[model samples]
Target: MSKLDKTNEHEEHTPSSSFSREIEKEPGGADIQHCIQCGMCTASCMVASVTEKYRPRKLIQKILLGMREEVLTSELPWLCMTCRQCEERCQEDVSLAEIFHAVRNIAAREGYIPVGVQKVVDTVMEDGWMLKDGYSDFIEDDRDDLGLHTDLGWNNEFVKKIKKRFIDGGNKK
Candidate 1:
């Protein structure tokens, strides 16, 4: 047998494991095995419409093929907007948005968070909101000055608790 022929034979015979099974082992990955690659999810995806790199259909295919590492490391998981449109459109009723969120959390726990996401997380940790210095800094007027009837309050304790519960818990919510 020739070397090229042997290599081809081995490649053709490799058994594919279920990447969906691995992801579904996690919290938000339920129903991932139901995906049937109907392309409806991708067709309705706002991110996919604007960017060629983000495609829910393709992501499902990669997962079904057991490309766990590639799916987790690539920006594909982060591109989802969690709109649930894909889930609604899915013929198999797969929760694509939830699955994406679950995968993103896993990636973050593995220290694979993108720089932009890290910055937002740091901001949330520092302040009660995701914006740095809080939203008050962006506005020039106080509640009283703006003639607002209600008063705005900042609870540092609440922010601390959230950090301890979420971020410190390895981004597991």
Candidate 2:
């Protein structure tokens, strides 16, 4: 093999054990002791299987090593679908999905919520709904569609009752 070819081969085969150690220092870091390094989480992760750089196993390694800069800022962190497939497949019950959430939460607290996710959060905060469109768009006349009685006055009464119950339950806010 040529010199360049040899370098490429080394890069492809070398495991990132050093980086894995840095990740372990992170808050709510993945339990490295629990990981068998069996690659089951990576095998089951939809994000990892599709994106070579976003492997859950690698992420756990990163967390173990305290690689906060790389772990928090990487697009790979946000790419997780939070499907819990890795969690389900792990014989160790490592809760990779929860680990992903913790990482994402840390990123968000540090002002790293991706623009796409930030936009969704903004919409929900402003509209009290996931979609940005007006409430009229969601409200419907059909009883089945509304999931309640079609009578508008009855609906108002129902809402009042709910509000009263909430207040009585000390949920005034």
lDDT of 2: 0.62
Write down the TM-score for model 2.
0.58
Note the residue pairs that clash in candidate 1: none
| 89-133: candidate 1 lDDT, tens digit per residue | 666667888888888888888888878878888876765467433
Local distance difference test scores for all models: 0.71, 0.62
| Candidate 2 ranges beyond 4 A from true positions | 1-32, 132-173
How much is 77 displaced in model 1, in angstroms? 0.6
Best by lDDT: 1
Q: How close to the true structure is residue 60 of candidate 1, measured as C-alpha lDDT?
A: 77
Cα lDDT tens digits, model 2, 8-126, are: 23211223355444333445444444665678989887777676877888777676556778888876778878798887777666667666777787788788777888888896664
Query: Top TM-score: which candidate number?
Result: 1
